[model samples]
Target: MAHAARGADAVENDAEGLRRRVAALLEAHWDEARGYSVPNPSIYPHLWLWDSCFHAIVWAALDDPRALRELEATLDGQLASGLVPHMRYGDAGPDTWLGPLERTSSLTQPPMYGHAARVLADRGSRPADELLTRAVRGLDWLWERRRTELGLVYVVHPWEAGNDHAPRWDDWGAPGRTRADYDRAARTAWNKARMHDVTFAADGSAEWSSSFVACPAGFNAYVAFNLAELAELLDDAVLAGRAAALAEAIDEHLWDEEEQLWADLAVVGGGASARSPTSEGVMPALVTTDRARALAALRQLDDPDRFGAPFGPANVTRTHPAYDPDMYWRGPAWPPLSYLFWVAFARLGLHDAAAGLRARTIRAAWRSGFAEYWNPEDGRGLGAVPQTWAGLVLAMGA
Candidate 1:
């Protein structure tokens, strides 16, 4: 018993140390003169909206005002069309950040602007109406760009949609694209699991190995959440009306009743192939969705042999043949995935379930010491150690 106690104590100490290191790393990487910038390891000044927002929450816990500043940097990148370009070119070259032209795909990820805005509100960090308006405009942009005649936002880039590991990619790659076509100079140094086409660049930025397109789950869920919040804040019934319609459409398209989960569409036959379903699916319960059928669809959340592992939620459903615990993006126990599940449970009033998942997530992240991703069955770390987003997720302890 004494030995067991000692072992437990050792693990606790290790977790505490990791938390501290994460805090320090965040502080060091913060570039105040440049508006509290946080770069993806290999590239600098190419701002990412979701990543910065994830870090901002931790910053809010530490210094509320700086957290607000971090968000400003993200908002700065929003285009006139309400499109928040995935990256903000600061000093990096074309080779960095996936060709650096704000992507050609008309559809981009639903910027979870409302969530970030709400976070700021929690801290009493108010900027200006202009900022909020710009965010809203970005949402409007989505309604225009992504919404099809069917009203569902079509995701053009997997990364833009925010479900980076969506099962759809395991089959059909980006719409009519291949890894060899990517500019090698833009590969991010921080991401270890990449298939970069080039080793070097003129601007010292490395490129990526693989390119992906159009996954819809997280992007729509986020937009739905944003629209809901906007409806409340602005009394814009039109916004809410459109958002509701989009939600219904997304449910109809993405929810595979047979699989009982949310997944992105996959393309077949290279660039010329038609879109199909991929096995890399995640539970819709990961995000807040109010469609009546959503709950029934998520019943598979705790199926022991499939997704319910000793850790927490796995990005890919365990039943899928492609479920590999060691793969970088496919079946990894990612903090972002767990983060969404934590929120979804809380929102649904599944307090007990939420608390349990939160604990597992915290345990996994702390144990992994903020690795970029982890093995689904064990808390062993993999990929980038002390990753910024992982640390932020850890600090968000449920």
Candidate 2:
């Protein structure tokens, strides 16, 4: 909070110190045998899709070769059909919900490796040529297989949106929102009831669960962003066109002008999306074609009544009935998400706002000791301590 009042030189110096601390924490979370940074050595103990992507970006910013190794490690357990699983257990042991034989998750998370690869190359690191090809395979697979009729990448689970605790999926529970009302037990039950809907093959591909097949604005924005960047890096016209079309589709179908935020489109049509204003709702600014729409969505970050926390953007509106500054995914200021907003803001020429977020995020990461997420209201650490993704503030402030 003081960052806004502090002199620019002082803020930059403070950020450099925070960067050093984050770099050390990232190193501590690195799993040598696994070749990737675990989210939290104690709590998570496994690699995740978007987390590793954020780690790679921070690693590259630090000039660490681990950045390349992290990306390579991410390809492990990838399906033959090019679906990049959201989680890879390796020797850490499969999660109980994943079943004994299953290692990688059947579902995919937000696709950000393409954007990570671009960040790596931008840093002058020649990630193997095959890496780009591999990343595109996953994107292509989503477009061909998981795409809803809306032309947006359809995600089967809320985890794919990476905002697991957000209220968008509250319809799953009736008196309790399908037990999704901050109840992990109920959420798990809700999951098992329909887990059999999708049948997996030997190749790790599954018939996607159609009941929850919805296009989340945040998820598709990352896909569209990755495609657009990869297209430029690879010089592919077809991919470029697809990226443009995807972005345009997000505008045409998902933009909720009244909310000034992108709303997740539920195909089945029951809840109408709860209309909960989430930080991820602004993610479409990364790829949306309309400058006015992008600016308006991004300015939500500057509004105190909405996302304007002293730390990075709040996970939800402060006015929301369920806003929780310390709850995971409820309203914490996550470094990776803040980093995304910073990038999006800068891309649209909102440099001042982006800089404020950069300072605030780095400060929060510092004060929270690189926790998994921080209290949006007070910058107190919550969730896993010394998590690697918080290190992403290095790249954000840089």
Candidate 3:
């Protein structure tokens, strides 16, 4: 009994230490001048869309005053057209292939700010009218300009998908147009091959010809999840109906029955689905009312042949030949993704699974010195170290 008690005490102490370190890391990344946390100092120094969303969520969870403040930064480049650029603040956020703009990226990322803002509201950090309005505008802009005829959201660029190097793009790859293009060279090629003619609409959303198009399970899932949350918070029935329609579309188009995984749909020449398992495929559970499908997708995480990993589910499943433990998106364990997945599982009533994922994610980030992403096979930090994404660990406690 005494030995067991000592072990438990040691575990508690370790958790407390991790919490302190994560807090300090988030503080260090905080840009008081900008009133938002920079994702990382070395590689990613500019403000980003989803990164800011996660930062705001972490701050809200800590009950810190910075929650709403950080969230405000997410709207830094909101145009009159209601589109918010994926990255802003400076040139570092812009890319050579696009966004010849002065300060913002030409594209948008997953509209995670909606979910972040709703989380803050629930925590009594409800944003003021301006914040809420911009949030709604951003969503409206995407719904109007970006939604496919199928009612599912489509990403014009692979980068917009936020899982840049994911194998879901392999079918439209540079070479085979269907090869396993892993390290992002194909994606870069696609970017460079663009017409280099980007025109901004009256609303300020960038418009380009011959763009890449795909409907990702994760991106659409987040759309549904965020829309559903915002509708409930604001008592908007139209948004609720839109959310339900989108969720139904995701179930109809993205779910792959044979594979028992949610596959990303590439919409370039036609509709092509990814065959390999990916962590993003499991995200629909957050809004999926199809219990049987949600449960099937959830089971993949427990299958060692697929997403199962020591840290969390691999970005790409372990069984795939493309799974590279140390690579960026191909197989690393990303903290922000872990948080999203944890919420999805919890929403699906898998409390124990969510708890395990939350604990593993916190420990993994702590052991990795708050990396941007890390090798899931080991606790080794990879990508940008001392990243604020690790700050998400505080949110797991919430």
Pick by TM-score: which candidate is best? Answer: 2
lDDT tens per residue, model 1, 113-211:
666676666667754688778878878877775565656665544556564543455344332123343233322331222323323223322221233
Largest lDDT belongs to which candidate? 2
Q: Given candidate 1, what's the lDDT at residue 369?
A: 59
> Which is the better candidate, 2 or 3, if ranked by lDDT?
2
Q: What is the lDDT for 119 in model 3?
A: 93
For residues 85-127, could you state the per-residue lDDT of candidate 3 as single tens digits?
Answer: 8888653543455565567777888889889988999999999
What does candidate 3 score on TM?
0.90
C-alpha lDDT (0 to 100) for residue 366 of candidate 3? 61
In model 2, the Cα lDDT at residue 251 comes to: 90
Instruction: Give the C-alpha miss distance for residue 152 in model 1, angstroms.
Output: 0.5
TM-score list, all predictions: 0.77, 0.92, 0.90
| lDDT score of residue 23 within candidate 3 | 72
lDDT per residue as tens, model 2, 205-315 = 654664555688898899999898889888889889989989988998988878899988876533754466888889999998899989888988878898888877898
Each prediction's whole-model lDDT (CA): 0.57, 0.78, 0.77
- On a 0 to 100 scale, what is the lDDT of residue 264 in model 3? 83
Report the number of backbone clashes for model 3. 1
lDDT: worst 10-residue window of model 2? 1-10
Order candidates by lDDT, high to low. Answer: 2, 3, 1
